[model samples]
Target: MDIVEAVKTRRSIRRYEPRDVPKEIIVEILQLALNAPSAGNRQPWRIHVVRDYRLKELLTDAAGGQMFIMEAPWVICVVAVPEESASRYGERGRSLYCIQDTAALITHILLLARNYGLDTCWVGAFDEKKVAEVLNLPVGHRCVAIIPIGYAGEPRKDRPRKSLSEIAVFHE
Candidate 1:
């Protein structure tokens, strides 16, 4: 699907079919995510693709018992290493710039999943410390989000959204 269609149709898939998501597809999706712009090309994000059932359970527990994580065939943990970013903007680059860059990568992954006939849920409700421990993330890396990817088990309806006129303000 095209970008516009994908953006309109993509939804947080909570239920998934009992199927496997191949490593190659996951890698390609991650590669697309890496294509996102970063401050000074630091590329401070690290993606950990988890397919193990036990680790998935741990992630579900880390996410306050969100069972959909365990049900999905794959869970991608997006991590940000602030210290790895360029210090041109000083502390702001470490905190703000790196975080924004990582979030952009996550957005890319989500959209590309839809284009590839797959679905994912943006999970930011998890306990970061627990997630880091579960994934054994390297030092100075923080778990920004946990995305569960798979084929949808059921249909999803579009959620309510504010109109552009209501959200956007024009100064000129």
Candidate 2:
């Protein structure tokens, strides 16, 4: 699907069918994700693909009992490496830039998933400490999003959107 169409149709899919996603498709998504834009091209993001049943359950528990997360056939943990950018941008890079980069990567994942006929939900509501423990993340890297990807079980309507003037500002 074209990028515009994908952006128009992409939805935060909560329900999924009982089917496993092909590894090739996941790889494609990862490729697209890695190509996402980052400040200074730092690309300080590491993604962990979680398919193990036990681990998914642990993740759901860690995420304040969000049951829908476990329903997807696959989960991608988007991790941010603040230290990767800290050398050049200092505290701001570590605290903010890395997060922005990771979010960009997640945006790519969301769009690419739709392009590949898959669905996903951007999961940010989770316990960061528990996530780090569950995934055994490195010291400087932190979990930013835990997205569940799969085929949509049912159609979902767009949530809603604000007016352009309310969201955008004129600079010139």
lDDT of each: 0.90, 0.93
**TM-score of candidate 2 on Cα atoms, chains taken together:** 0.96
Stretches of candidate 1 exceeding 4 Å from the true structure: none
Clashing pairs in 1: none
Model 1 lDDT tens row, 34-151: 8899888988888898999999999999999999898899999989988878456678888788899999999999999998999999999989989999999887899999999999
Candidate 1 local lDDT, residue 157: 75
In order of appearance, the predictions have TM-scores of 0.96, 0.96
Write one digit per residue (lDDT tens) for candidate 2, span 1-172.
8999999999988899988899999998999778899989998989999999999999999999988789999999999999988877999999999999999999999999999999999999999999999999988789999999999998978887999989999999
Could you say which candidate leads in lDDT? Answer: 2
